[model samples]
Target: MSLPKSRLLVIGCVWPEPNSSAAGSRMLQLLQFFLAENYKITFVTTSARSEFAVDLEKMNITSEVIKMNHPSFDEMLKRISPDLVLFDRFMTEEQFGWRVDEICPEAVKILDTEDLHFLRKTRIEAFKKNIPAEEIYFDADITKREIASIYRCDLSLIISEVEMKLLQKEFNIPQNLLHYLPFLLEPISEEEKLSLPAFKNRKDFISIGNFLHEPNWNAVLYLKEKIWPLIRQELPDAKLNIYGSYPSQKIWNLHNEKEGFIVQGRAENAEIVMKNAKVCLAPIQFGAGLKGKLIQAMQCGTPSITTAIGAEGIAGALDWNGFITNQPKDFAQKAVQLYSEENLWENSAENGFRIINSRFNKEAFQHKLSERLLNLIQNIATYRQKNFIGKMLQHHQHRSTYFMAKFIEEKEKR
Candidate 1:
C-alpha cells in the first residue's frame, strides 16, 4: 500500500544561510531530502530577512515569515495544519511547539537540533579556562533548557552519536525520543573525485569554518599561538589559508603574509578553496557535535589533521581519513608531512571518500527516518503514552506558554 505524502512545516530559528553556517547547510539538506521524497514543505521563520538567508524561491521551497512572541503564529500554524512540524532548534521548539500542540494536536513534532547548543556553550565555558568536560557539565544551565525542549518534541534529530549517548547516560532521555542523523550527502564517485585537483595540483595548508562559532575561532587561535609557528619552522614556504564567513577584527588581525598566515573571509566557493588546499587543519580544543567544515574538507578531496574533539561524532569506528592528534608538535608535523607526500595524501583522500559514503549517505538515513516517521504517525497515541516524561513536559509547557502568550497579547493591545 502506498503511504500518504506528508505536508511538512519547518519552523526555523532563522532562515538557512549555507554560506554563513553549518546550521544553514544542515537545513538545506533537510529541505532537499523532503523534496526528493516528494513532500510539500513550508519553511517558516520569525527572523527578519537578510542577505545571508538562502533563496527559497531558487530552490522551489515555500517560505513564510512569522512574528516572534505573538498569537499570529498560532493562526498561521492552524491555517497550514501540516502533517508534520519540524523545529529548527531548541529555541524554535520552545517558542512554537506549544502552539503546534494546541492547534494541530495530531501533527508529529520533530526537533532538528543542528547541534546541542547547551553542549557547545558548556564546552566554550570550559575551554576559555582550559578545564575538562566533567568540570563543565556541573554548571551547564542551558542543558536543562535544551533537555526540556527535547522531551517536549515527539522526536529530536541529533547530529552526533557521542551526543546521543551523552543524552542517554547523562540526561536519561529515552531512546525513542532521539534520532541520530548526521550530515546527509551523496557519495562522491571515483570519476567525480578524480576530477578534483590532485595533491600535486593543490597548494598550501588551509582551515575554514564559520568564525561566529567559538570552536572555529578558538581553533584558529590554537593554530596561530601554537601550531602554525611549528609548521612554518618545518616547511618555511608553506602557506596557511584561513577562510570562513563573518571574520571579526581579531580574526582579520591574524593575517600576516610574512608569517605565511592569510585570513581570507567568505569563500566565493567554499569547495573551490578546499579543493586547492593541500590539507585542512582543525586543532579544536573543545566543542560539541560534528564539524561541517571537516566534512566539507573531505568532500573536497582534502585530508585533514584534527584533534579528537574536532573529529567527534563524525567517523564512528572507521579509521579517520587523516591523522587525529591533540599534541601541538605532533599536529604540525602531520600537517607538513601530509601536504608534501602525494601517496600518503592520496590514500587519506580515498579514506575520506569512504567515510562520507559509509557514514553520511542521504538514502541510508532518509529511509530509516521515513520509516520512523511512518511508525510515529501510525501509533502516535501508543508512542506518546510510552513517553511519560514527554507527556508531562508537554502538558506543563502547554499551560505555561499559552498563559504567557495570552498575557503578552493583552498587554500589546493596551
Candidate 2:
C-alpha cells in the first residue's frame, strides 16, 4: 500500500488574488508547487474573500476562513496535523506560529516573506525624508519584530538575493535559516518571442502595478508631477497609460486626455495590455523584492525605463530590457528613444527574454527547492539543532504571544 501523502498547511494573510497583485501571484505559484509535489494542501486565511480572489476549491485545494486569537484554530490544527506549515508572511506567522508550535511541535515551520516588510517600510521612510535608502534604520521597531519572526521560524524563504544578503550580512541571520527564492517562471521560447507583437505593432507608454502598493502610487504621482510632461513634450501625440488595481479617486483625477496621461484602472488581462505597449515606465523610487510588472513586461516583450530601485534583483549582470535612470530628463529621453527606434527596441526586448530564460527559469528553481525541502525534512532535527537562535526566539515568542493571544480571546468571550 502507498504511504499517506505529506500534509501542507498555508496560513495566508489574505486570500490569493493573482490578478490583483504580485503577492497574490507569488502565493498561487507556491501553492501550485506543493500541489505538483502531491502534497495535500489546505489554505487558511483570516481576510475577507474578495470577488477577485482565486477559487481554491476549483483547484481541489482545501481553503477555510480562519479566525484570529481563537481556540477553533487549535482544534483544527489537531485534526489536520499538517507535516508542514507555510506562513504566507511574517504577520501571519506572528499570529498563528505559537499555536502551531503548541499543537504540532514536530511540524516544519516555513515563513515565506513575500518581501522584507521592514526594508520596504524603511525605504519609504527614507524616500519621504529625502535620504538614501542605504541609510536604513536597522534599530527600527518593525525591524526588530520582522527579524524576530525570521528567527522564530525553522526556515524563511527570502524572495530577493539582495534581501537574503541583508539578513545575513546586516542581521547575522544564519545561512541555514534562510533560502533565496525568486519568481518562478517558464522560459520564453523563440516561437513565443516571434509571436509577440513586434516593436512596430505596439504603441504608447504603459505603467501598471497594484495601486494599493505605496511604491506604485508614488511612481504614478512621480510620473504625473515630474516625468510624463517631458516625454509628452518630445512626442506630443504619445500617451502614457496607467493601469493598476485599486486606483483611488486621486489616481483617476490624474487623467488628462489633452495631456495624454490616462489612468486605466485594473486591466482584465495584464499580459494583453503589456503586450500592446511600446515602452513601460516604472519610476519606482522605493520598493522591495522583484517588481512583477517589470517581469510581466519582459514576458510580454515590452522594453521598459525604470529607476535603479525598479530594476533591483530582477536583472542581474545582464543588459536591462530598456534603460535605467534616476533623472527625469534622461528617463523621458530614453523612453522616447526606445519608443521611436525599432532596432534598439528589438534588442532590448531580446535582452528581456534572455534575462527571463537565464535567471528565472521555473524548472531549475523548482528542482532546487524540491531537493532542499526534502533534505530539510529528512534532517529536521539536525536542521533545528543548527538553528539554536531560532529555538531561543521560538521559546520567548511562545511565552509572550501565547498569553497575549489568550487574553484577547478571553476578552472576546465577553
Local accuracy of candidate 1 as per-residue lDDT tens digits, 41-98: 8988988887888889887778879887688887887778898899998998888888
lDDT of each: 0.88, 0.92
| Candidate 1 lDDT trough over 10 residues, lowest sum | 1-10
Tell me, by lDDT, which candidate is best: 2
Residue-pair clash count for candidate 1: 0
lDDT of 2 by residue, 251-284 (tens): 9999999999999999998889999999999999
Question: Which parts of model 2 have CA positions greater than 4 angstroms off?
Answer: 1-5
Error of 1 at 271 (Å): 0.6
Candidates in order: C-alpha RMSD to true structure: 1.6, 1.6
**After superposition, candidate 1 runs with Cα above 4 Å error:** 1-5
Question: Cα deviation of 319 in candidate 1 (Å)?
Answer: 1.8
lDDT, candidate 2, residue 242? 95
